[model samples]
Target: MPLSSEPKLISGNANRPLASAIARRMSMHRALNVELVDARVERFNDGEIFVEMFENVRGQDMFIIQPTSNPANDNLMELLIMTDALRRSSAQRITAVIPYFGYARQDRRAKARTPISAKLVANMLTEAGVERVLTMDLHAAQIQGFFDIPVDNLYASPVFALDIKHHFRGNIDDVMVVSPDVGGVARARELAKRINAPLAIVDKRREKAGEVAEMTVIGDVSGKSCIIVDDICDTAGTLCKAAETLINAGAAEVHAYITHGVLSGPAVERIENSVMKSLVITDSIEAPEPVANARNIRIVPTAPLFAQAIMSIWQGNSVSSLFDHETLSTIYDGFYSAS
Candidate 1:
């Protein structure tokens, strides 16, 4: 595709590798090959954060590739400051390409008095001069409504569907797509339809944060491989318990395809000890060594999808078309695999 203008790509401390991969994809496609803007984010002696963009972005299309992952507060602050800097520098358009949007879990107030941090973050980004937001698999789809700007919420279903098809060698009838809880049924059901598999739901009740009160498999998982689908897998308390519940209910094996592997606290240890066959995640957030090195965990790259989405936005094309099976298959064949 011929480009009218070259968009500058910027990276934060959250995930430099993903940013580099996205730039490479742009070059491979000959779409909008632009180098990452020279910028430095440093920390002071007292642990304050500072960001300085060296390259000129005046009247340019700028895309900032940063995931608000671990050390979410600091990384988010870096993005905000960078957006402010770009606005002051006269950038024509600023798109915040956040792969894994943090604070998305706090989208609603479950208690009597609590802050909707997701909306607050959206307001901060808008006020910081971000014109658009590109993110994937929000914890709650309603979070997209919180943003006033054009928000592109991408899906991991295409990627996972490709991987699952390869892993099962197009024979997915014996595989069951499972939702760990009621909230994730939509995502799980979509994957189930993609692979032509049966649907199952785990009726799990969480009495409190980080604690699952009860888990009951709602469908027949007997003698079938179960794949739990969810957006985030933080702490793994619910995931591990769900796996055990599935196995106890006669599932031949238990696995998962989660979008973001926020795997905090004892997540790695819990996965290692759980009965789960595997836990697949996308490179939306950087996985720590324990997860990368784990035998039961696999991470798929998401740069290609984001690269195409960014290119489409720059070209004024439709980003939703990329989700089509035929289109996704062509894209995945070039980059993704069972590895």
Candidate 2:
């Protein structure tokens, strides 16, 4: 693919490894032309944030790669400040390449007096002068409509499918794809169809944040190796609970395929104690130290896929083929067996 002469990739302190990996995949050195000034966020007499960017981005097609993961607020503030700085610098265009969009679960007002924080965030991005957004596997697909700017919502399914195929060979019959909750049924079904496996749903109820009660399995998982799929695994409550339910339902083994691994709080310990054999996640969010040290956790690099998309967009090429089911299925089968 021909590279765009004006494409400039910038990254924040968060997930620098992913940014570096993406840069390598894109065949470019770290974007040294631009510099990110530390905001030095500190508390005054009270408590508030203070941010500032120490670089100039005038007339540049800047892509800020930052995953709103752990320290979501701080990372988010950094992105906002960076965007503001880029705008003030007179950059040609500003694209926010967020691998994991935080606060995305609250896309709509769940209660009468609630706020749609996802839309609020979108408005903030727009206010900060973000021209476009490039993100993957949003908590809710409809959140894209919140942004008036062009939003490219990428899928980790294609990447995960390739890995699954390589690891499982062509024996998809023994595999079952599972959604941890009803909300993720569509994602699970898509992956299931790609792998030619039956789909299952873990009927669960969230008593509160960080707590999940698994009611029952909606589909037959007996005698099958199950793969629980979801957009994000934060506290691992839903995933671990679903894994236990699958195993109790006579599943041969339970594994999880999640896009973003926000393994916070007791998530690592929970996964370690759960019935899950392995937890596969993409490097969308930077894995914490505890998660990186865990035996059951495996991370797949998404740098190549993101790089490909960036290259395609730069070349003004269609990226729909990247989401093709048959092509994805073959890739998944190959990756499953290889791994």
C-alpha TM-scores of all predictions: 0.96, 0.87
Please give the TM-score that candidate 1 achieves against the real structure.
Answer: 0.96
Model 2: lDDT to the true structure = 0.80
Summing lDDT over every window of 10 consecutive residues in candidate 2, give the lowest-scoring window.
Answer: 29-38
Q: Candidate 2, TM-score vs. the true structure?
A: 0.87
Q: Write the per-residue lDDT of candidate 1 for residues 1-339, one digit (tens) a residue.
A: 423368789998899999999999888876455678999988899988888889888988899999999899999998999898899999989999999999998989998889999999999999999999999998898998998889999999988888888887745778999999888899999989988899999998878876788999999999999999999999998899999999999999999999999999999999999999999999999877999999999999898889889988988889998676557777767554533
Per-candidate Cα lDDT values, in order, are: 0.90, 0.80
Give the RMSD in angstroms, all C-alphas superposed, for model 1: 1.9
lDDT of 2 by residue, 229-298 (tens): 9988878877787788888889999999999998888899999998899999999998778888899999
Model 1: residue 197 alpha-carbon error in angstroms: 0.8
Best by lDDT: 1
